[model samples]
Target: MSLLIVGATGTLGRQIARRALDEGHQVRCLVRSSKRAAFLKEWGAQLVPGDLCDPASLPPALEGVTAIIDAATARPTDSLSIRQVDWQGKVALIQAAKAAGVERFIFLSILDAEKYPQVPLMEIKRCTELFLAESGLNYTILRPCGFMQGLIGQYAVPILDKQAVWVTQQSAPIAYMDTQDVAKFAVRALSVPETEKNSFPIVGTKAWTAEEIIRLCERLSGQEAKVTRLPMNLLRTARRVARFFQWGWNLADRLAFAEVLATDKPLNASMETVYPVFGLNPEETTTLEAYLQDYFSRILKKLKELDYQATKTKNQKKKTSLRF
Candidate 1:
């Protein structure tokens, strides 16, 4: 079957494409620039030029495709409005999907998006979920709490580099699942009849707080983290400043997610109902500890190798100078 993956170059979307390709499915990626997504093409995915912001460019991309997995979200640094891509553009994509007679529509939404209607990105996701549900198309909505891939840059690399790791009033515990695991469900959803028209919350095995993550990184990297805790008022003021400019709307929408930090609740859900339907094993899921350990091991090993090479070169230079 031919699978069209939206946001094929994104963190989650790329994993979905990889998994689908590995399963021997014909994979087509809806991308804005084939030049940038050339790596995916090398990985055996067909790239179709398309943009979520451009309604006219969607239908052609969906032609002859069996299903769609939309893992696309507007980035904080994006030039376009989140609403334009997440809501309006998605609406156009859905309408076009229905018109194209695509078999399944898999949507990746944020957990508890409905609770934060004030947050532009979350609200857009919540609305898009509702739209997909009522669109009369065979659909599966996967609400993932967060992605662990974000931690490498957010905490791990920064700790290794001795940079400031930012935190906040941080009350919410998040079960940040690996994007690869989430991708498995998205790819399997197309073949599973039971998953049609259903929504499931996909999260990590355990939830973690900011302090816990910082400590984990410190232990793994054997380095004390430089922690920087920003006040809620400061973030709010920054968000307000961001809203004043058209280019800043993306950052403003993303900063609104800080509301999660103030909430008492954890952004997580039980997989008891989720894994069975997808025919996936919970034990096989990647844990936060294992993920971090692997990252640190590979990185530390590379650093040690580089240091050895440098020391060897310095010693050789000294021996030659002393002989001369």
Candidate 2:
């Protein structure tokens, strides 16, 4: 009677695990390395050694598990390929869930995955969604835009460090949600029968373009940002060159995300219909501005503390030397 979380070590997965645990769910984490996932163990999730790439591991992992939160995906840094993990691996997982007779399956997918067949991840996700629908298991597919946590590295850090913040010339606004917010919907899906066999777009209240984010960072950090814009044509050419080699398909697959950003359409979906079902208020979602403000305040305060300590140490050395 445990709620199993696949990809428990991932950014979104970690948040989901925490939310489930906080809400008093019996949590189990399927991970490749239990040692590396010690933090999750510390957070009170039962760790089971399992890998999606190894289909044999699925059956045993699914034993006694009533619900599943599938947040696993083929990351760019993963040793496995998108075809191996995202596509084939997910297929094995779905079949296992159906056989195990899990009560509810919560899948985390991307927004507009069906619209972009050219992107490998998007294409794979769309195919998986169709497969899951036909798998005979009650499922809820949560399609979210981007994660606001990623902006810390993509914009906030580089701006605070006075380094180049790379952006696309044809940038589209994206409504990014905090992973924690998305996690709330995922855990709530288990008890909410209305969410079963349905799909919902879980996104932030407002859509923000890259330019607006850069300006916000500049204002918050009080630092002039070094912005570098990559032309869409150049990005396409880079992707083309990357696809020329068999070994580069992974890189090419990752570059395919550029297509989503290099468009006029916003990467947002209406959440008006979604809020009432999950009993979640729109105001509870974290805004990008507030997220950035809190991050800068904490970071700047730490930086000031470090600077003061360094100056104090230097002054103490000078006094000691003068006396000597």
Candidate 3:
């Protein structure tokens, strides 16, 4: 079957593409840029360039497409809110798919989209999910836990620099999923012939409190890693500052802080729901110690690369000024 993966270059989306390609499935990916599409094509994905917000650009991309995996993520700083992408964009994609005679719509969602009210991101997810349920199309929804990758972004410097990660008391007990695992489950959801219409929450192996995670890091990395529990007040103020500078910062920060941090994490969200369905179990479960060691190592390498690039750029600019 020809599968169309929207947002094919994103963290979750790219992994899904990789899994699908490994299964010998013909994968077509919708990318926003020619550069990205060229890169994905080089990696063996059939790349179709299109924008999610513009409906007029979709039909050609959807032509002869059999299924869609909507991995599109809305940034809080986006001019359009989640309603635009999660709700309207999803609806448009579904409508276009149905119009094009495509069969299935698989959505990548978050756990507790409906039950959670403290975060706008969840609220938007809930809305899109509700719309998908009522829509007259074959659908499967997958809600994954917080990603280990979410912690790997360049901004995670504070945690890396100190050889420790700070957290509020809420994230004391945290359970997050590896992005690779989430992608595996998404591929299964797409490949499985059964039309299961239930929302499944995918999680990783273990949940560790911030302190426990730090202890693991210290043990694994052979470094003195400390877990500094910051006051809620400081976190909130930081969030406010982020919001002042960015549009989606308020919602994004609130969601991360209120929803994931201040909560009890359970294994229920992990591969338990999906193991039997996918006929696959996680063989490599990353322990807090192992995960941190690898995570820190990667960040250190990236920092070195970035510093080298910046120095090169600065030197080139200085040479240009000297020539003038």
In order, what lDDT does every prediction score? 0.92, 0.92, 0.72
Per-model TM values vs. the true structure: 0.99, 0.98, 0.79
Looking at model 3, residue 73 earns an lDDT score of 79
lDDT of each residue in 1-324, candidate 2, tens digit only: 489999889999999999999999999999999888999999999999888989899999999999999999887766578889888999999999999989899999999998899889999999999999999999999999899999999999999888999999888899999899989999999889999999999889899999999999999999999999998888889889977976677777898899988776899999999999999888988889989999999999999999999999999999999998
- Ten residues in sequence with the least summed lDDT for candidate 1: 163-172
The best-first sequence of candidates by TM-score reads: 1, 2, 3
TM-score comparison, 2 vs 3, better candidate: 2
| Prediction RMSDs, each to the true structure | 0.8, 1.0, 6.2
Once model 2 is optimally superposed onto the true structure by TM-score, how far is the C-alpha of residue 277 displaced, in angstroms?
Answer: 0.3
Candidate 2 residue pairs in backbone clash: none
- How many clashing residue pairs appear in each of the predictions shown? 0, 0, 4
lDDT by residue for model 3 over 1-324, one digit each (tens)?
799999788878888888888888789998778785676787788888777788988999999998888999776556665666766787788788878988888898877666666666777788788877887778899877577776544214444566446567665354677777777777787667663677777766776566665555555444564566667666666666666754655454444535446656542455565677777766665544556678768866887899999999999999999999
Candidate 3 Cα RMSD after full superposition onto the native fold (Å):
6.2
Taking all chains together, the TM-score of candidate 1 against the true structure is: 0.99
Error at 260, model 1, angstroms: 1.4
* Candidate 3: C-alpha lDDT: 0.72
